[model samples]
Target: MKSNRMVLVFFILILTLWGCEEEKANKEVKTHGAYTENNVAQKMDKEDKNNEKTAKNQDDNNSVQYFIEEEDFQKFAKKGLNPFGQEKKQINLSSTDFEYYIHGMTHQKVKAKEKWDFFEMHPKRIKWLLEGLEKTKYKLGPDKQKYREILKRWKQKDFSTIVEDHNFIWDENEGTVGKATDRLSQEDEREYLESEYEMMHHFK
Candidate 1:
């Protein structure tokens, strides 16, 4: 009888220990699941904040106001004088627009082998354009750095290397140096300029 009672006691003790272990395992599983859920929530919150920040930055960039408008460029181009001519009306252009205008003007001048007399005659206008560029809201990078240097040189009344500058831009645009302006005949160049001017004014 005592032996049976001892066996019964041993069985009861075993069941109690097994129950405690199962409860401990269940608690550990719940804790792990809670930790995983918290991690997911935290990760989602971080991603949402990052997306909001990126969207805000895009909005800010899109909302930037430029000093020059397309209409202003059209009016300026219609006069058929050198873009920097002394007789032309003064128009302020943002840095970005100034860069575009300079490229078009320089390309035309180089193709036509025109004199740089406009630079000499339009000192005040050039100074005003440079000032407008200087106050632009956009950040200047390496490419724009070249424009800045050109503007500074022009401000100092030095346009001796404008042909070299034109070639540099030409090469930068992936054009062959040997065929920079040589490949285009006078008639071809004029046609190309007319098409380019129409496309620039109308498409934008």
Candidate 2:
């Protein structure tokens, strides 16, 4: 009987120890699982924030659409092709439109040898040009008086005589309108760059 009692006590002790070990193992597994879940959630949250930032940046970059309008060009056209007309009837173009216009006309898309380079600019640039007459600036020099007479003659024929024609006017004033294209002056270059940067980044 004494040996049996000792054997029973040993068996109970072994079962208690096994139960504690099993509970400890289960608690460790639960803790590890919670940690893994937390890590995954944090990673997902970080990715979501990055995605939002990317989308916001894209939206900021594409906020403004640069395109010329026919009505605006027509308004500029009503001011005539001469320097006075150009100065008085300046086309209200945003910086983007101006950039597109300047690049679209001068840059050649095709090879250097090609004479007929494609005008692969935005369709708006073409629209403003096809409307007949581009925006220009007035000059304060001896040419001003000369331009005044030329403009008078241009208006005399109900604006029918195209100054672009060499035969339409004096040889000196033949390409005068073409020469006086409206461009951002040297002083405005810095302003344009700063505005462009701000528009892209939304900087203060």
Candidate 3:
């Protein structure tokens, strides 16, 4: 009976030790799982913050910075109106205003009997317009480079084929001169101008 009691005690101790080891193993597995899940959550949060920062930076870069007031820019867009007057104030022009000024000059060139008359009559006006364009910050890469080339030409006072250049641009984009006059209605002309403006500057 003593031997039987010793065997029973040994078996019970072995069972107790095995149960303790099993419990410890289960606890370690639970702790490792929790740690892994926390790490994954922290990684996701960091990624979300990085994405938000990138978006905010892009918004700041894309926002337009104007050189002049909105009202003054609109005033410069009026047909047949020259922005540079006899009494010259401090010249402030935006990229949009520069394009509008070009459009007005082109219209004047088309109306004048002598092609070079407008350039001759308003040399100071032309000079101021060019200076304003040089000073203005351009939003589009293509437009900036294009105007730079034109500025180089105009600075040399070489406008021999300006009318041809105007006609070619109009013809290639919209239609022939005859089509513009006879076929295009007033609405069509307005739409064309609006489309052209949007294409050039990516703004309305």
Instruction: Return the top candidate by TM-score.
Output: 1
Candidate 2 residue runs with Cα over 4 Å from true position: 64-204
lDDT tens digits by residue: candidate 1, 1-204? 999999999999999999999999999999999999999999999999988866754553344332234455456567754335323322434444554445544553345343221121134444655665566566555666677677676556444455666666555656543323433333553555565556656967
Q: In lDDT terms, how accurate is model 1? A: 0.55
Alpha-carbon shift of residue 15 in model 3 (angstroms): 99
For this target, which candidate reaches the highest lDDT against the unseen true structure?
1
Instruction: Give the alpha carbon lDDT tens digit for every residue of 1-204 in model 2.
Output: 999999999999999999999999999999999999999999999999988866754553344233334565567567664121134223443333332333323222111221221122334443443232334332234533433443343233211222232222223423332231233332343344454445545744
Cα misplacement distance, residue 183 of candidate 3 (Å): 23
Q: For each candidate, give its TM-score against the true structure.
A: 0.35, 0.34, 0.32
Whole-model lDDT, candidate 3?
0.49
Give stretches of model 1 more than 4 Å off.
Answer: 68-204
Displacement of the residue 94 alpha carbon in candidate 3, Å: 3.8
What Cα-based lDDT does every candidate model obtain?
Answer: 0.55, 0.41, 0.49
Q: What RMSD, rounded to one decimal, does every model reach?
A: 18.2, 21.1, 18.9
lDDT of 3 by residue, 6-69 (tens): 9999999999999999999999999999999999999999999988866754553344232224
Reference-based TM-score, model 3: 0.32
